[model samples]
Target chain A: MSEPIKTDVVIVGAGPIGLFAVFELGLLDMKCHLIDILDKIGGQCAELYPEKPIYDIPGIPFTSAQGLVDALLQQIKPFNPLYHLNEMVETVEKIGDPLFRVTTDQGKVFEAKIVVIAAGGGSFQPKRPPIPGIEAYEGKSVHYAVRKMESFRDKRVLVVGGGDSALDWTLNLAPIASHLTLLHRRSEFRAAPDSVNKMMALVGDGKIDLVVGQVTALSGGDGQISKAMVKTNDGSAFEIACDALLPFFGLTMKLGPVANWGFELKNNELIPVDSAAFETSIPGIFAIGDINWYPGKLKLILSGFHEAALMAQKAYRYVYPEKRLVFQYTTSSTSLQKKLGVAPERPAAPARAAT
Target chain B: MVQITFIDSRGTARTVEGEAGSTVMETAIKNGVPEIEAECGGACACSTCHVYIEEAWREKVGEPSPMEEDMLDFAYNVQPNSRLSCQIKVREDLDGLIVRTPDRQA
Candidate 1:
């Protein structure tokens, strides 16, 4: 219920394209506030494939997913873009022409002149496991993702799935849990070998118990889990007593509230944008990155970069209708360099008198 | 150059020649073929460029990678011959390629 934070642009999604959009909008003297569902800045790059090598970036031969994110973070530091992580944008209302009010799931509101959706693949929602009556325990005992380790302290913790989140939370919460159990449908995990090794070591030391089974049911009272009925691959069923169940079943993308933002949509998901300014059906509202659709739209980061450049040009007119735009390349534009906090070259240091 | 024919949902077809070493999605975009939307530019990230390769040219275009297949899951009207046009590279042997786009991209 706090006062809505005001900015020139409100960018949804903190992916590499979103980050780059900050630089583009910043060069136009438009301050930005970026909102993302993930707790971190990088979207799939940092979350899904941080170390994965990406070979398609222009100008750079190759870079790791996270490396590109890190470079972009450094590049946008001069802009000082405000970040609102771990929050999903829930509502977008056009208050005026070229003015919008955006609200997040966390109750934070942002008022801006332009709303840019750089949301790659929309909002990432955790894939919930299929278990009868599990919905009642959600946000109480059965959690999809661990938000705080302190919440699991001195509690019976059962971590599920074979991904990195399962192994990570199991390792992190084992020391503090009254009893820790790691459960998965398969014996082999999709997590990193080192994390798997460390988890096995914990099992060896009796700090944790590894169960190869899937949760079929949850028995609890007053919206809290008391025990989990697990079914093993060998057709064996057993009950594991636990107070907290952490299921890391990976994430699925949802258009979320963005779908109802009053823009024309294709397939009831992505926003349809024009090729010129990447603007949606709504004026001053631009859609870039993977969340947008056009006749020749490409979901590549480089394509998003190009879209961001064009979006900023059109956005500048909306933010400053009277001011004429002068396009300039950063390689020779001193004002652009100044905006990026780069000092001018000192005339080749006067050659030091030929010393 | 490689000649590729794109068939729209309404059975309209457009034949265009694309330079070698570029992707089918890129070539289609450049030639203003409405079938392939190459949204993500030629990145295997979006399924907007989903297409059904002609049965005759299936062996030539080859199969999609597991990554590309995952993206195709989001595409509309995916068939057994479904492949992301972005993942299909233009080559000399890929001449006379024919593919049909879905009614709408998912």
Candidate 2:
């Protein structure tokens, strides 16, 4: 038999929510193993639009996705959570009370006392456009985004899509690229008004070319993107020479291996979970984030935050029933200033009154 | 039909036949390839079907959509050549393509 590996918790997916779980679990002085499919952590916040501003998350007035990820990482830095990147979790089975057999595509197995299925919409896959010859130039000159801006320095680039991702990349690439072109099937952009306004300014100054048309064909030379054939709505066609092409179209989410785990699903898609604990029909297993479904659950980052905390608490109670949680306040001062150096001059007011 | 080869993390290579327009993920799963777990049924919502394209064939497989890129951030074992097999539609040009499965699947 293989040597048994054990931990307090195993968190799948390194996205913002997953990292948040690490933060919470750390606060409880628990050890955890964090895994992600990507080479790095941060999940959607790090991968999708790191620069895009997120306004809804509490506490911060406005923060970029990457910024939020950085802060959360800092919060959990002291816990020393173990991380396994570029690894996909294929199966999660409950072997006994609070014990799980987690297997991966690589055949490595991990046994943990508790499992948190924070896989988050499973593996994320992209949807490609049906443009003819688009696949002809994959690595040489065509890309999904200018992932690293330095690579596109002094090169002519073509960007497709009117959405936030496309527009954002275009604006970012405008200054570095030798020449930049933006193509969209429709004249109007789907990006935020601020981004659209920036693109308009760049177009007005001739820093970038905005072509209103759809890409019909892609031709490559020297194993890289060379020219693109675009057809306008008014029966006009043109070809633009380019060194690289980036398509910022969005991605779709797949259920991954969990789909076959035999959980009851609603609408033949989302996994049905308990309204309170977010547990699926399978005991000791829980689903959170966009992949879960219930009567009145709102699919948002904040809601996922709430779900993860509650799931952790319930899982903790199951694993260590003898442990009692205690909250200690050194003093009655509500604000930071009074708590630091001086005891409250008045007898501690009722805790409820302070609120 | 296009014949594509997939190398599991263990370096075992298996070839599968894919009909034109079917996704690489579909071809692998239909043939009982163990590496790809297309969790979202090819909707681009999940990154479970992630595969790394051979460097030589990277240019042949175009860039992923923004949605796919975003999803890829959530995938396991992502590489510069990483692409979601479900998002890649099989065609005659991709007949000799090779992809490698990550060491783990989410």
Candidate 3:
């Protein structure tokens, strides 16, 4: 119950749309604090396909996914928006007319006049490998993230996946675990060569066992796993006894806490918002980006930008009830340019040598 | 038009007309076939569109690319015949293609 950080707007999900919302809100003199479950901003663009080329953005004919995120970060630099990363918003309770108290899972709180949910595809959570009855051993024996290395001390550990997460954990825990096994579907690994070579060196030293197989089933009792039934490429099935299983299948976006926020959802997934202001059923709480659904909702970055501009217009009324709002363009209005920190306009790098 | 048959985990078979050169994932999504969640929208970045090619058509469907193979690491119940439906394009030569969705996608 720390003192809540008060702000004019609290934007959930620091994705492209949320980042743009900061610029829009900043232009209107509304300060924002963005919260995201990811440790870094850019959401899926950075995590899923940072190298993928995006061609749909207006004006910019070509830009990579990470390119857009970096540009957005640069565009909102003047706003100085506070970011609370590695935190998931737990609950949002309306305390006043157009005012809400937001609480994160990490116990950080915020009191704001507006709440924007630009959570594109929701939070990226570790994919739960669809093993039958694995849920029973989730917290007890099965885990996705390694919060404490000492927890696996002296316990037999099974690390799954061919990525860095698997190999890194395998190498880190091999010393402490009574026995360690690395199970992957194939012999080839997607992890870095250095880490893979180190893991192989460990296997060569008899410190860790490498198995080319996939876990199909788990047998256990009372929320503790006894053994996991594995199937190899040749269709042979075997069992591996272990006290811990760490399956790092990478991340998948899920409509996590957004579903519990009391907003009316269209398909148990997306929040139903008005096409005009992009506000949800609740006042002062708006949803943008792919997380929102309207009559003709198009889940695109350009569409999310349009939604942010309009949502900010409505958000201004909540943050500044008695003030008059006159929309001005950044190109023509000196006041807007002043807010952008280029009031007098800096000389343009000598016109690029007139090439 | 090429024809594709998709069988869900429960063994429910769905036959649909797929346009040649279009992706198998696009055909399933357009025809409203369930169990094919192309979360990345055919970018091959995600493994949600994972499917197992029928043994008879395994050779015709061809093996996965190196990139698809890497993404398959995130999929469930992956076998030698498994493929991401997004990477499989419809063709006239493969007039009768059959694929089965896994019990769950990653």
Candidate 4:
């Protein structure tokens, strides 16, 4: 247990919408602390589709998903939104009207006047394989993702799954591993055609072993896996010796602890929100982005942007009920411009324009 | 001002006034009509603002772009008259624009 970090707002999920919400809330003089499950910012943009191009953004003709996140990070830099990455929110308890305390899996607690759930499709987590006794080697010999390639150097590695992550890591770790094995449920793969071809090429070159079977058991001592039992599709089981296991079973979005917060849920899954303010059943808690459901709710980035704007309006009232709010545009409002660190347009410089 | 009629999931009709050049989705949100989710504002990246344009006004609304049509795949119970309201710009000629929302937008 530790002292909870205090802020004006606590935003869950550091996705594109959540990042934009920081700018809107900051413009209103509210400080924000953002919590995300991934180790980096930009949620799915960075984690899933950083290189993918996104169309339909209003201003720019086109931008990569990560490029959009980078621009947003630069836009909100002046706001100094604090980020708590690599942590998932575990509990959110409303202490008072418009006041709540949020705790993360890492034991960090945050207190804020408003809680904004910008979690896009909820938190993306690795789907664990149904191997018996696999939990013992979770952080030891078994890993869902590779953090350091050096860790696998000279070690016998076993890669699982049929997706891009599995094939990519298998290709990357093959050269360094003393012995590498790629195990999947079938010979066919769900990964990109190129990666699958490359993996087959590796297998053909005898650089690695490809086994079509399911890992059924783990055998190890001292929390380290030494061997895995694989059941082939032909109903034959065999033992494969390995020291490191990388399972890329893909990611599943779970509502996680947010589901237990007791807000009225729509579809027994998504949070029901009032279109007026994007507020949830709770007075202080608000749901935005893909986590919310309304009569015509569309899970798009721009829609989340609108929800964030309206949510901020009501949040401002909750944070400062006695203060009068004056809506102002960044273009004309000197105060807002100052907060954004923009100098007023001055006499044009001929040399600057020529360059 | 342009007048737009929005039918909710329950078949309730509400007529609201929208400023010229503003999106139909924007107008519905501004007027506190819950039928149009318009989650993406006017980005046209989502189909949450899907609406059925009246047969008489379908030609005026025009056909959806390929991208809008692609996004409509994610909408629930889409019809031939379905259009993403975010792409429909309010104008003087659309003074009597009539559209109805679907049962839900996934």
Residue A10 Cα positional deviation in candidate 2, in Å, after optimal superposition: 1.4
Model 1 regions more than 4 Å off: A147-156, A162-164, A171-179, A186-208, A219-226, A346-355, B1-106
Please, what is the whole-model Cα lDDT of each candidate in the order they appear? Answer: 0.86, 0.77, 0.93, 0.86
Predicted model with the maximum lDDT: 3
**lDDT computed for candidate 2:** 0.77
Q: Which candidate is the best by TM-score?
A: 3
On TM-score, the stronger of 1 and 2 is 1
Error of 2 at A2 (Å): 7.1
RMSD, one per candidate, in order: 9.2, 16.1, 4.8, 13.3
Candidate 1 lDDT tens digits, A1-355: 8799998999999999899999999999999999999989999888766877888998899999999999999999999999999999899998987789999989999899999999987787876666778889999998887778898889999998776788888889988899999987656676788999999999999889999767888998999889999888667899999999998766656778887889878988889999999999889999999899999877788999999999999999999999989998889899999998885866565555555
DockQ-superior candidate, 1 or 2: 1
Which residue pairs clash in candidate 3?
none
* Top of the candidates by DockQ: 3
By TM-score, how accurate is candidate 4? 0.61
Q: For residues A1-355, what per-residue lDDT tens digits would candidate 3 score against the true structure? A: 9998999999999999999999999999999999999989999998888889999999999999899999999999998999999999989999999789999989998999999998899888999997888999998999999999999999989999999999999989999999999999999999999999999999999889999999999998998898999999888999999999999999999888888999878889999999999999998999999999999899999999999999999999988889999989999899889889989857677555555
Against the true structure, what is each candidate's TM-score?
0.69, 0.49, 0.95, 0.61
Residues B23-95 of candidate 1: C-alpha lDDT, one tens digit per residue: 8888888889886766455656556788899999998788877677555544544566889987888999988
Q: B2-101 in candidate 2: lDDT tens per residue?
A: 9999999999999889999999999999999987888656666566798999989998899877667666645543456778988899999998889999
